[model samples]
Target: MELNNEVIINNLVKRFDEIVAVNEVSLEVPAGSIFGLLGPNGAGKSTTLRLLCTLLRPDSGTASVAGHDILEEPVNVRECTGVLPEEGSHTLYPSLTSYENLEYFAKLYDVPEEEAKKRIEDLLKFMDLWERRNDPAGELSTGNRQRLALCRALLHNPSVLLLDEPTSSLDPIAAKRVRELILKLAKQYGQTFFINSHNLAEVQRLCDYIAIIDEGKILLSGRTDELRRRLQSKQVFKLRVADNIETAKSIAEGLDFIFDVSIESDSLMLTILDPVSNNSVLIRKLLNANIAIIELAEEEMTLEDLYLQVIKEEEQ
Candidate 1:
């Protein structure tokens, strides 16, 4: 089944007495996809998430999760969604066993006993925690505890997952596993995920759509690949030459399309307006002049680079 706006927000506004946390923000998350809410420390990503999860009612706005209105059907919305907050510890009972913890949450969500047992076992095995299922949640290593916390959130088979910094405290290996699991769940169950993260590379790899927000406002939002393509039009290309880098720089400076070229020990860097369709022409022109190109590669801007640029511009 196609996702019909798994999560929707319109004119969302929230405040904390004197400080505005969310400011008329609007966004939509298509079903069965990972939508990233990326921004710096105080970008209001968390406030936006809380509004959708029905944890905190918006001062003014309309939102729906899984077609259930945030204001009109908040209980129903909560029933269909699971949230992994920034602090996973908040959801975990440190004194309980992994299996027992999931069992309790499953019961709270009213999962049938028989089905809950099977799901709990399957999740424990899937997370490679079956052997340690009997262990105390407080005794597990930090990564193992995080994995257990994830299983807790999935116990009721939620249709939509609201994750905040899922991998922030995980090691590299654990983080990769969490990423793969997120993808697997989305494909297998057609789940929709709304993720808040500052890990740019991770967002670029896992999120199909991304929104960069700052100071309670969205700076940019679009398909990840499309954003990169649009930014590609403003990329800088680096050309390493065997020798005569000075001469190559002089030639590059004269080309109008070349925009600006800087010289290093044995390389020339060219910042262009748009080289998507002109890279080949630039290369041939240099080769024809005996520039002996060692390596000509585009130094594409990363999501982090774009994020920093956006934040800096917003500050100014």
Candidate 2:
């Protein structure tokens, strides 16, 4: 699908003192999709986010958010986007109730009182915070507080959402709810979401597009499905046989297409560079050897696996 490319970043760079926070990073975020900025800590994700939100200036390169240049038209870009900063604690007023917090941010954003009130209530309900609307922000659970923070972020209904670790502090159930809500909002309202997360499973399940960064540069970026396809190029498979587990594994190790072989419980795992064309021949060879075939399956690679691969490749 051809996306509108709500976010276009080209050769972006940011430096602090002698430290380069973001370096020559570039990617396009499609409109109306959940895009994940994923990496380990200190991988430049947050710094890139800061630049995009206009909280920090890039030393070089260019970025535009929602059709507005981040550097040249910061105010317009800010007006077009809502940011749920990493410091969610600082974003919420501890002494104020959830409703009051939203009211305050709404007013700050110049949302009219009548519209703000209705929207606040709608957001509270949408985030499942209605019952706790009157509760003080300081006293709400981490999850509730996070929900309140999100409500404040949406108060102005900006075209894009820049969320940094939206579910960092929530319990699994709460995190799941937040994930579901993110998907719902992205679909129902056609809003573009840029999420910075260290949660691999969350990113894998939620984001349609992803960018993996390390040090100060982008290691890889593309559609999630495409990335997975790239991983399939390094596919591996495990086969089980009743006898000669060791001998069968030796045979697999000798095959031209096989990279390595290891023994598992009642099975032999073959690490192959290509499985699509080699698997059938390997299985047939084992069957002809009178080895009782019990199980045969491809090893599925997780997002964590792919992430490790990206980081390792970048390191080398």
Candidate 3:
């Protein structure tokens, strides 16, 4: 049977006094897909997540998770969805040990006793918290606590997962592991994920599709590569030459398509007007000018680039 869209929002809005925290936001997250909500701080990413998870009721709109209406069937929605809020660590009992926390949630989630025991042990070992399993949750390091919180979120294996800043306090290695685990779950278990994150690189790497939200409004949403291709024409390229870097800069500045030429330590930073058509033109001009080119490459277009451009356009 075809699964319904794991999460859906329509004309979703929320407010806190004079501040409109979420303004008529709408989105659809397909089942078994990794969907990322990307935005700057205070841009309503967390608010949207909170609303979907039934923590906060929408002021003027509706949302659903796992085919259950967040407003009308909040209990059903919560039963089918797992959540890791922005302050995920705080959701754990301060006095409960890491294993105890997961054990407690496992009972609430109704995982069979034997299964919960084995699942808890495996998760602790996978997160490298086995040694600290007996330590009180309040005593664990911030990174360890974050891992523990993630473990609790995954304990019941719900159909939909809503994670806000899942790796916020984690170190580089821990963060990477968390990202890897997300992919693993989505692929092996076919779980749908709706994530809120400001980590652009992480989103770029993990998200199958993404939406950029700002000031409680969505700017754009699409596949990651397609979004990057939108700004391909305005790509930036760096040129390095074995000799006569200034002369190369002059050759580039003479072209109408080239602008903002900066000479940096034997290299030149160029803002190419239409890189698809003009990149080779600049290379030809430099080679013809007797500038022994060391390397000429277009800078990788990142989610940061698309995000900044979208945010800037929205601001204007």
TM value for model 3: 0.87
Inter-residue clash pairs, candidate 3: none
* Residue pairs that clash (backbone atoms under 3 angstroms), model 1: none
| Alpha-carbon shift of residue 71 in model 2 (angstroms) | 1.6
Task: Give lDDT tens digits, candidate 3, residues 1-316.
Answer: 7646888899999999999999999999888889999888899999999899888999998888988999899999988888998889999998999999999999999999999999999888877789999999999988888888988988886899999989877888878988988887788789899989887778888998888888899889888788657766676788989999889988988999987899889889987877878888888888888889999887765656666666666698
Please give, for residues 130-163, the per-residue lDDT of candidate 1 as tens digits. Answer: 9999998999987788888888888888899999
Give the winner by lDDT: 1 or 3: 3
Model 2 per-residue lDDT tens digits across residues 57-82: 99999999999999899999999898
Q: What lDDT does each candidate get?
A: 0.86, 0.87, 0.87
TM-score per prediction, in order, is 0.85, 0.85, 0.87
- Model 1, which residues run further than 4 Å from truth? 1-3, 241-248, 259-269, 285-293, 308-316
Backbone clash tally (model 2):
0
> Where does model 2 exceed 4 Å of error?
1-3, 87-90, 236-245, 262-269, 274-304, 307-316
Weakest 10 consecutive residues, lDDT, candidate 2? 300-309
Stretch of 10 with least lDDT, candidate 3: 300-309
